[model samples]
Target: MDMSVTFGDDSVAAAAAEAARKLAEEGVPRALADGDATLWGGEAESEAAIRLGWLSLPITSRELLPEIGKLVERVRAESLEHVVLAGMGGSSLAPEVICASADVPLTVLDTTDPGQVRRALADRLDRTVVVVSSKSGSTVETDSHRRIYEKAFRDAGIDPADRIVVVTDPGSPLEQSAIEAGYTVILADPNVGGRYSALTAFGLVPSALAGADVTRLLDDAAQAREQLGADDEPGLLLGTAIGSAAASGRDKLLLDDSLSDINGLPDWIEQLIAESTGKQGRGVLPVAGSEPNEAGDELVAGIDTEGDIEVHAPLGAQFLIWEYATAVAGRLLGINPFDQPNVAESKENTTRILGEAGDGPLPTGTPALVDGPVEVYGDLPPHAKDLSDVLTAVLQDIPDRGYLAILAYLDREAAFDVPVPPEASFETITDIWAAHDPASLQGLLAIRTDRPVTFGWGPRYLHSTGQYHKGGPQNGVFLQITGAVTDDLDVPGKPYTLGRLQLAQALGDLDALRQRGRPAVRLHLTDREAGVRHLLAAAREV
Candidate 1:
């Protein structure tokens, strides 16, 4: 498809079309010649791969199902309870997806929430299974989690040795740790990226947790991959057509609602697409989900007027369209799409922290707090009693952090505890309190501290508080929470009804905030029975 496919901007399309023809005539599969404004720099590096016909179909040659099945069986035989996964980016995103899709209930200590860590371990202890996952066997967040688990297991009287599983490269330090600690180990495929690891061990942990039919999920993914190879990939042509428009001075944006568990999956895809295809000045501006209703229109303003928005459903099949869109966009703009700028520093950061070789101290204890009044707002649900009942109990029972600020819009309230000493037992209590809240029908309390808390919130909350969360500030730790994928609102039936769209927008905003590096966590439910019980478990104790 050449560049004539645009939204009535014929001149730009004509320009792109002329460039496309020239590149084709020069024996290029899909590349722009000198000074073309449509191709990205990253794609240039992969010109050889494109020329060798490696970019057309089946970008990978790995088979992951068998390995996942074996992992599941091993967990089942061990009678494992909770699962704490270690990994960041792609390695972690896939497992997050499995957790979202699974049929059974499983607790994921995915984010770096000390409260989450404490709560996850407190009740289960020896019964919990820790899965340390990193493609390079060196993700900092994963490594930190591993160390925390080590401390937790020791405190809980559990043999961290038997309860741990290492998923990484074949002969890395993580593998060595697992071996020395007497934990089971699994190696990630060398060829897979962190984001791509979901179909592998990344997906296996949650699948096993939920007791999902791994074979079926993998079968679906395999089918989706095959469809991408075929001519039927839903948005492939549409996206490519959009790319043509982008090359013609039309920037693009992607509105996707798939793989919401990995809070920042869309953002990750955005980089993969944008960096790979944004050539010269011609590229797509990627946006996922809506944090607040207003933010969408803000981003939409710039792109929709000149470019197009490609909407995607939550299925693996649609990924092909984005991939192709990037490929074509890169060629039209004369840019390479694979070379990432400053990506090495990111990788190095992950490794240094995981290995505890970084310049900063491994942060622990309560975060430092600035003296101020803690304003309490928002009406407590009728059943929640009063502010003190919610605040004191929550603050006391939930995990404790050094600094905490709670803001509610309805009422003006503040707590000036002169030099409130940091609580020692902050971690586990907070997790229990969080899991226990919804049952009591308590108004939620979102706490933030100036500490690194690894988390990923799914897309569901983007429509609600996503805007304030992201545009606000980098102060305090953030935990964006949501439930698993279930019955979605039937938007078609209620075109004017905004409930469904609002839900999706909240999810999208959540995705945006996560992309900016905020931590997120999602709780999935098969039904209300256990979920309600778990969410409200803290209330009973109170």
Candidate 2:
């Protein structure tokens, strides 16, 4: 696959060239070759384990292709009708991209939303093979999903072990659990971080199961790897472009792909770049699936994958290129690419909240109904009258080089019901949130605030953008929205329902933001549609 990058203007191009020159002078190539962490920052030694593993993934994946191929065939021959992947962030995103373009049937269950969980396990329990994927066996969301499905299979008079597979690092608790449970286990390289494991078993196993050509994918990645090692590498050039643009005040990366088929590619890249580089008060923000902007502070990189094949070589190449470029961009930004210092804050908060649930009722602030179904929790910031007002206020408070992030805990499909039947098609339940047409809301916010607006779905975003929001710069102004989960689904043996889990995640994240002194507010809405209308009205008011 051939990859090319063109800058928006001559100044951006010149900046990239200078950044590349500096990287060469700083001995980045040698550092990468020798697995030195100096390029990351002063704390390279501490983050060495996670940072160096991804460097060799392309080569390692190539060597493992045959084994992966055999495993794929074994699963296919079992005649499973659907393969469900339960994971989050790095463990799930790459498989999602492959499933989108492949011939095999696959469904990804990353959200703890009971509705989504039910949808994924609804029908076809006997014929469905569930891939419980997590780099660390202990991801709460993934474990919750695994348990839910385990009970579902038991209820259906099926052996959960017969239909289960595990993908995780060796010796992780999840590996032992899978082994004890009699499920097939695939051990991933311990050194590869979740975001950088797309070419490893984490990504390849699912791609192969989806009937995607894993060989072609890895072959393409190998080609890109060769290019990355060259003196005038595209990865370095692109990284220079990104780093240079960020340095020149165009830190917002507006990524575009001409092929609609490869849209998910950008979503995966968003997490890769955002989580990897967005930290230590300086980072590159990737804008995907949002309105096009020509702001002076924006740098647009268009990806044109002109043709479609069973195996998306271009997409595979892109995975490698971005990984390389993001590392390069990290070196330029003077931050450790592998360490997510703030991501654990929210997780810890969520764990604490969950553990203390027995201490008392979950805290709920007095709800103040704004216009329509919109309601404000606790105290609204001064000058904020409604949901829209609160959002507008947050937008106004964005600092220089800051971005506005909307964290909505509402159901993505707006269906408040629980435990959708197993026979229902996954598509019927995975509809994009309609209440606040995200694209329209994003465009309005961009025009009004003249800053990037990122829309993150509940719990799911916690795994992806949450790292950047808390660990990156302090420039973000967050608007967290929570709503009533009318119907709740229990996790069989667990004490809480999926609805409770979702709310806990939201509250925990909101609390973490406040603790960090980040400007943020929580709005609890009584109705999804009314909440959205009120939000749009507020944007119009501005």
Candidate 3:
């Protein structure tokens, strides 16, 4: 099993084979390889025309090798060996997998949580070199991170230009500002979108600095390039199988990466699949980091796990393959894979909420019910008794064929210090959730329902599956978990603090979900640790 995808020999596989045959006859493989925007019809042309740059990344990204290597050597020579990646979504997710697979340590700051940001700021400030990456350069979270790090570097008597490297599109705001600031700037291909940019500078820069063999990663991707363009190839078969299954009502994609040599690939796949195809109220919902169950409306795929629809690949090729397959899947779903129209709803709401709030505290509404350390915020039934009742109501609200999304806007690394049992372990929220019903809020809630459960750290998922929750199908009930920031960290030049930003983001997304008439419940942990314990206890009761 090497950089290939094999479907089952049953009727399901036969149907997929037929879909692939039809697609090949329709010239999908060749058109996709040729970067033809017309493959997705007229509506997707403008975005698709540019977003297809990922197809050429394997060949085009190699030119950055010499410069990146030289930069790494210079940084290490200056004793700046600690690589802190200040990026969100595609900027952060790919290097995480690369560094994890290479067994190298890379501190990825992709959160607005005060504790998480403070933790990153406190760690190895002297030897740290921050890689600030943003495709659009206007991402609030990344911008915030850049500002704080610049302040920290300046306060430490170190010039930010020597300690910071910027990765953005050639003319992005960050690039222009970084050039003026005298910081090292690495321009990503302007043609590629954030989620589809694993092979671009956004992925390569951070991983190379962290001592990963990024050159080998590109080499592996190139090896699979020719195969992806031909009929009956892994990319074609995979795209058609998953796409057609989804078109036939199996819209929930159950991804299992347990047997893969690639570390933390599912999250990347989750963002890729969810953000790309999840729009126009139609998309494939990627249910990753869960115990794969044989559900009626779900398609279970394993990365290197020998079962139905077996997918095996090097981490590099894995990124390219899944990306191409997702594009094909989007074609079948009749949605633009390149555009994320609904993702900005939350961001716009956040901005509006923040702007309206100004320096004053964000509007805090009364909770529907206060149970122990937890304050439940939602339109729950009036007769509901306690937290368990709220849990029951939320779980019951999940319609048949619907899924549960637990979006935690708290510090993602809050659980990093805890110990895991020998059977399972995890590095970060970017890593997979333990499938063995581990003592987690998601695991506990999962036991109460049979529907697919997904866990995402907020602001991070805002760039990933955030699109799906708003633009995808209506069959999703969200459980938003926000916690009280014990010690808030203030952003250097912003009117809002990190804790406030996190809360506003959570509230903004909640408002958007409610506006869509989606069933959403917000549980605020007024006492972070105690609330977590009580929430878990209530989930267990349910």
Each candidate structure's TM-score, on Cα atoms with residue i matched to residue i, is 0.52, 0.90, 0.96
TM-score, model 1 to reference: 0.52
Question: What are the runs in model 1 whose C-alpha is more than 4 Å off?
Answer: 1-62, 103-110, 227-235, 238-285, 291-314, 319-336, 344-542
Local distance difference test, per candidate?
Answer: 0.41, 0.75, 0.87
Once superposed on the true structure, which residue ranges of model 2 sit more than 4 Å away at CA? Answer: 103-105, 258-261, 305-313, 378-383, 414-440, 528-542
Give the winner by TM-score.
3
Error of 2 at 293 (Å): 3.4
lDDT of 2 by residue, 37-71 (tens): 66676666668645577667778767777777776
For candidate 1, the lDDT comes to 0.41
Question: Candidate 1, residues 1-542: lDDT per residue as tens digits?
Answer: 11111333344335545544554465443332111323444434444233222232232323545665676677678877566665555555445555554535555543433334445556566667777776566653466567767777777777887777777766877788788878877665553334334455555655555566655544444444444422324333344445565544334343444433323345445444544443333345444432212222112211112333333333333333444445555555555543333234323433333345233433221312211121122222344443234433334422222111221111000011112336636665455444433412222332211111211232211211222234333332332223332323221222211222222333343344346654432222223334444444432444
**Residue-level lDDT tens digits of model 3 in 167-263:** 9998888888999999999999999999999999999999999999999999999988878778877777788888888888888888888877778
**Best candidate, lDDT-wise?**
3
Model 3: lowest-lDDT 10 consecutive positions: 430-439
Displacement of residue 152 (Cα, Å) in model 3 is 0.8
